[model samples]
Target: MNKSTYKNQIKIITNKNQKEIRIDKFLKNYIQNISRNQIQKWTTSGKILVNKNIVKKNYKIKPLDFVEIEISIPSVLDHLEYKNITAEKINLDILYEDEDVLVVNKPAGMVVHPGFGNETGTLIHGIKYHLTNSNLNNFNLYRCGLVHRLDKDTSGLLVFAKNEYSQKHLFQQFYSRTIQRKYIALIWGNLIEEKGTITGFIGRDPKNRKKMTILKQENQEFNKGKFSVTHYKVLERFKYLTYVSCNIKTGKTHQIRAHFKHLGHPLFHDSIYGGNRIFMKKKCSNQNIEFLNTCLKILQRQALHAISLSFIHPRNGKCHFLCPIPEDFKTVLENCRNMFLQ
Candidate 1:
């Protein structure tokens, strides 16, 4: 294998011991941060060649074959289907910005990236529009430098890398669990302890593919789920609900919601995990039920907010950010105090 000093192109020569393989699949394995589909696209565009000849994506290479791939630094947007994601004039609450990174306070109910139902008006679309028209726009930016993400309904501070170097650095910190992240949540029922940790293996539910659940003891041995841990502390207690702060040791899909639900205290208004309805504690008066219903009306989504985030910058030193709870979350807590504490 020979790579140019600037990494603008890559040339690979198959050895005698090398087995025949499809060019697209081989390149996908050889390249970093590139997908097979992107390789196919490059092949179609005559960017990838075999023996100095244009080839199809399905072309198989035998031993002693010579392959070359052109690296398009400025054309990185094509890999993300940038044209398909329309940039919109959306308001972005930027907390911090530098040559290497951009931190923004993402609001609740806003999708981070485009998906099936959410094709436009996403955070990425807004970021594209914001950067493309600004001086910060650069050729090395990939996927708007998104390293991590929050659920659509969860509001929090999110950091974006402005270049590939910063993106990989941030990703390493998150994977190593060195990044400190804390979330505040309102959950149904009171806790027996002031602080505790929930440990379990979490995976997708077989019956409901859209939802995640903690695997039972029998399924855990089979490695059907990823090990997850959530440490929580009671911040305030109501008659039938508890305000808590959660520090997750492992970042997984729906980890906080699934762990709390497994602990018999699902997050309040978490409809999927069964915390939306009124959870009766002993005999409740009709007035109390009505009051609980009012709180639910105030907070329609799960009561979860990423309050604190801290991490070491790739180029700079340590960076920390804090985002206060949204209005709906605050209103629900105030109403809980007024009715239960009073």
Candidate 2:
């Protein structure tokens, strides 16, 4: 669920002046980071439709015609050989575990899975070690029963399925928006509203491929990014910082971070979104600057922790999982409070 669900759908309404183009070529130009081969595969598999009817890859587009492309893209693990992932022994903060699921408190700075430049020392490697050593046959070697993901720098509760059936069931809950996820974050500025919702279309930043941005109306014309929503409530407010609770309505990449940033209050220490720098200060003095630097060092990452997660157990349907904030995050909050009090 860490990956955005909107990547599956590509909808377009042809402009009045739109020229006739092959459906595959049109899609390749419409969607960013998508290849023509992938578009053809989706078309051939009947995942592409024109005006509500399935179309061939070479189908010609027409003005005022509607096109909807549905893609069932495979997970990253599907492309990697299971044997390539080494099960490294690492200590995991187990929150809860059962025959069908496992809940763990993932620490900050831990990658959820191995990918391109990161091929080891990830949560997946540790999970593999734990499951294999425990002699559990429930997890697949590739995904290790993980159905969702957290960013490398985010710390908090994470749930993992124990089997294929449980994985599908849990994934469906996330896809359907039945799973509840609440995160605690210390942001850079005081929000004007105590509680509010942010709604925008989230897409990869054209300037920076590694970052996500809230698309403006003019920007949405061609990109048509996924719609994302997040609700936030202020818990405590300081002169320069605000503690808030964020509940995500859509699990897009960097949803919470991007939403908060769009509100002019990025999560504290979020270097990627420009929160690592000081946005507020009691006074422009060397002491204030030193204090802010110290706080940055203490946080080291985005000040976001997945404090709560509630989802029905895929097996029994009666089980729910929850976890408290981790110590590191709490310590940072306490330190910030003390600094403000002084």
Candidate 3:
């Protein structure tokens, strides 16, 4: 048993007598707490290395091969986090619900799930209470039926599966990119093209793990990140801002936000991406600046919303959902229109 553990890392060396086996399968057997899906994701993200070289999840272990895994506590013990989450009676803005699926309009400012500082009053907590009160106790509570997530400040459609079968089915659809999702955002600058597609690999910013960045080329670490494509068309144009509808081709973390930022047009009021600041002209009027500030004050977070989502149901054949932009988002847009059109 040549295995050792260090700070947030696991090291294992296959002995001469060890037989060949797929890395993911081997890791699942050896590590009791982790999942095979997480192993595969870590392998793809260059977090798992064999002989100090990144390899695919299926790479068979050779005798004397060295394996190193960089483990993050949050991701590795997500199940524990879910279990620790207490179900609070938070009201949910449910758009649709059935025996197998629950689609909700997750409001902006609400955390999708419990995390470091956001352990209570999350969407998952609300859902848990809803399910318990509804008397649907048999459903899996490990993740509270959550199949996907939305950013804390990005409002919109999110779907949860009620059973294991539906969860697996929906997971496959999301993994295969068969799920259709569209977002509408008010971004910082006017777009040069009315419609365009931004294609790049999205990875965590090396300097800032809190944010995602568009990788210019396939590097050792960036190669582990998923390739993303965002298709955008101008919905409306304001004086210095643009309203756009974006159809995402890939569901990478912060795909739309990072992609547009890579193009120098971050979503308006996205403080994390530098959209909260003013992009000004030398002769900009005081009225314009004051108006922009008012608008910003109206919408304190990123002006991005998942406007629509469509997917083939595991049981019902086809399902499509659309979420109207939240009040703050709507009001901000209206203010922009009045100011710009004048």
Candidate 4:
């Protein structure tokens, strides 16, 4: 990858309406190449500087604020790339770095690994391009230094082990459910209770086998599902929306999305779980109904983020880390500031 491509920016002329808006949002609308989630991560890690200050991604902009952003593309991924592999040199936000591990904030749209339609430019490929041949065991399915995997659309703090011992120790901790994984999500409706926990058996939905579901009492007895647990507290409420902090004890497939759905309060953009479709419907008024079918494709993913992760350093026994909140989620959360006063 070319190191020279890492340093750059374009003038974002903002009018009065957007003068005080967050920096992360501006990039998403102006820079088509990058996603909002990526900008959010960079903001949290102090990668995206405004006038050379390490401002929070949620910092409101002033009129004519000259924003100078320095995004370092992942470096020297010699092992992850070959003669034919095309890896996009996208910038990754490194929260904390050391010889033993790297805590990075992953973006919402990035697929974690190569798959059916996304064989190129995945998080795995990005890692390989930046830190070639990471300390990963052959048995680790997600590869690279990835000890654990996050859903492609969920943005937030993820750990990457720099060596074999750290990888194994972190892996075992996650397997035993010792690591704390917390998330912030905006779901439809004002969740009445302040905080609570949700526990149930989760299995593949028989009708739509691709998705996971919380089995009912009758089906739980003989279910092939795993036990799932989530603890959450409502942060604030929008008109018909609620921002919540979700802590997962057992990381099953689609646990956050499915569990919230089972609560009758699916995430705002989770279309499969009966999330708001009219929001997209209103955004696509000019198109024909046939074209409209896929017109709202951009809004299919939910607004969720991984904000914090705390765990013991398996090898060193240090209190490892707690990653900051991604900016996009902050932007969404900031929208509910009025809710607290009301």
Backbone clashes in model 3, listed as residue pairs: none
Tell me the lDDT of model 2 at 154.
91
Candidate 3 at residue 233, lDDT?
96
Clash total of candidate 2: 0
The number of clashing residue pairs in each candidate reads 0, 0, 0, 1
What is the RMSD, in Å, between candidate 4 and the native fold over all Cα?
20.4
lDDT of 2 by residue, 191-249 (tens): 89999999877888888878888987587433446667788999988667899998987
Query: Model 2: which ten-residue window has the lowest total lDDT?
Result: 1-10
lDDT of each: 0.79, 0.78, 0.80, 0.66
TM-score of each: 0.75, 0.76, 0.76, 0.63
Between the candidate structures 1 and 3, which one is better when assessed by lDDT? 3
Clashing pairs in 2: none
Compose the digit string of candidate 4's lDDT tens values, residues 1-342: 422112333434355555465676556534423566898987887766666678887887777666666564332232233334454666788777666677888988888767799888787667656665434334222222675668887888888876545665665566446788888888876677899998777778878887789987577432355557899998776645687899998778788899998988888777667774533344333433233233235344676788888888745565645566555556545544643335
- Give candidate 2 regions above 4 Å deviation: 1-81, 137-144, 220-224, 281-286
Using lDDT as the yardstick, the better of models 1 and 4 is 1
Give candidate 1 misplaced runs (Cα > 4 Å): 1-83, 137-139, 220-222
Report residue 221 deviation for candidate 2 (angstroms): 7.3
Per-residue accuracy of model 1 over 145-230 as CA lDDT, tens digit each? 67677888888888887766676566666645678889999999889999999976677887787888888757633244666778
Clashing pairs in 4: 77-129
lDDT for 9 in candidate 1 is 64
- Using TM-score as the yardstick, the better of models 1 and 2 is 2
Candidate number with greatest lDDT: 3
